[model samples]
Target: MSGLQPITRSSQLSVEVVWLSAADGVLRYRSEAHPLDGGVHPDDAAWHVSGLTLCTPGALLHSTSWRYARGSVVLTYVALPDPDPHDTVAVPTDAVTSGGGPLHPSPAVIPIEAVAAHACRHLALLAVTDPQVAAVAAAESPLWTLITKLPCAPAGTLHPAQTTATAPHTAC
Candidate 1:
């Protein structure tokens, strides 16, 4: 076991960011938010979703999504471009701290596809190792089924998306 522990729990979800000592990297998991009796927006129904973010020192690596439906979870990782200037939210630096000096450099601009692929590989590991995650994968939720097809990699093997190579990779 990786000794996963919760670092924070907000009203919406619980988050964990842990160092995988054996893999020499980090793994983050955010639990799905509980579904409201009806939905957040009646006009547009909302389903419960969880997220994961993976990063190494000096970079914001990848982001992933897990959507809950039909008593199962659907997983997807996609590279999302930086938020528009108008949509940016300011974070108070004083409220943030990390054992690792600084995990991301200012103005980090990683490609979305790379982030997605990297997230896929990590999700694959969780699918096999974590019972909950495995159940989700086994359910084969339909979200992103037409796209984001990701093959499982050997445990502990870093995918190309984690490398600095410039070649484009498919999203997961």
Candidate 2:
């Protein structure tokens, strides 16, 4: 124990701001990275980052998942903008990969694209099941459209087209 080096790791907050182009129907997004401030809770950090970076803070901001990569435990969040902005970093939905399922016997390597897709899929489920989330989704046209396009899956599998019967409760 004396000679062995201590393991070092950091926590990160990864925010995915997803929105639809009002005119072209293109789904655009921006992925932001921030340090987890020791003074702030991860949830509060995610919301603060979302509000600061987005043109308009989304009505629906929620933590979607967490992953270990690059020597850090990344806390991923999904934020949906209420009013679509003119300029947004664009990534096609097809770019999102279905590379791994959560329940696979062996560890599966997942890419950032799949993570973003999962975030959207999580929100889509919330919109339907949570009354508060449903209201927010309904108020924002672009957000609602982007959400509807996301795919869902049953308890075991991960697919964009299907949905789970129950979803975790959301704060929004």
lDDT assessment of candidate 1:
0.31
**How big is the positional error of residue 86 in model 2, measured in Å on the Cα after superposition?**
7.6
lDDT of each: 0.31, 0.58
**C-alpha RMSD of each candidate structure in angstroms:** 17.8, 9.0
Q: List, residue by residue over 36-114, the lDDT tens digit for candidate 1.
A: 4323441121211212223312112123534223332333332211111122222111121112212332112323233
lDDT of 1 at 71: 34
Stretches off by above 4 angstroms in model 2 are: 1-23, 52-58, 82-87, 94-109, 152-172
- Candidate 2: 10-residue stretch with minimal lDDT: 98-107
Local accuracy of candidate 2 as per-residue lDDT tens digits, 1-172:
1222223654444433433333456566656667676777887877776663434544567777776555456788776662435556554454444323333322234576666666666767787887877877777686578666666442235455765566666655
Error of 1 at 157 (Å): 2.9
